[model samples]
Target: MAAFVLRTHDYRTISRCLESYGLAVERSAATWPQRRFTDAAERRRAVATVTALGEDPAGTESAGYFHTRLHLAR
Candidate 1:
């Protein structure tokens, strides 16, 4: 399990990454601005997505941002 951050500017890249990872869009914010993913593959895909976006997973970007955490299902 891992975490990732994606910027809003590169949402297209993130969307592609999620699709490639076989993860579905769980939730999103329209006015406030937010996105979430629960699928494990999506999480991994997010890593690749963020990586492809050229932003450090541990760092922040100029336009958008994304964060992913280990889904500990209860």
Candidate 2:
């Protein structure tokens, strides 16, 4: 078996597809640095902050950050 991280915005759909392939999917508790905004408002606030700093929000990375681990069994 092998493990990998898949970054996606639509985890539910991807999880279903993985299940159909007989792969096990689970939310990992692994530690990693992930930048995230809790909600739309928070995201907007971040954009505003960056803009106030004279940076373009569009140039900066937007966060809808999600990751899941997959264990593939052979």
Give the alpha carbon lDDT tens digit for every residue of 8-74 in model 1. Answer: 2355555556667776543332222245545656556655666676645444221233453222111
Clashing pairs in 1: 5-66, 6-65, 6-66, 7-64, 7-65, 8-64
Best by lDDT: 2
The sequence of per-residue lDDT tens digits that candidate 2 reaches over residues 1-74 is 44554332325665677788987776554423246667887677656654564444453334443233444444
lDDT of 2 at 12: 60
Most TM-score-accurate candidate: 2
Model 1: how far residue 13 lies from native, Å: 12
Report the Cα lDDT for candidate 1: 0.43
| Candidate 1 displacement at residue 51 in angstroms | 0.7
Model 1 ranges with Cα > 4 A deviation: 1-35, 59-74
Relative to the unseen true structure, what is the C-alpha lDDT of residue 2 in candidate 1, on a scale of 0 to 100? 24
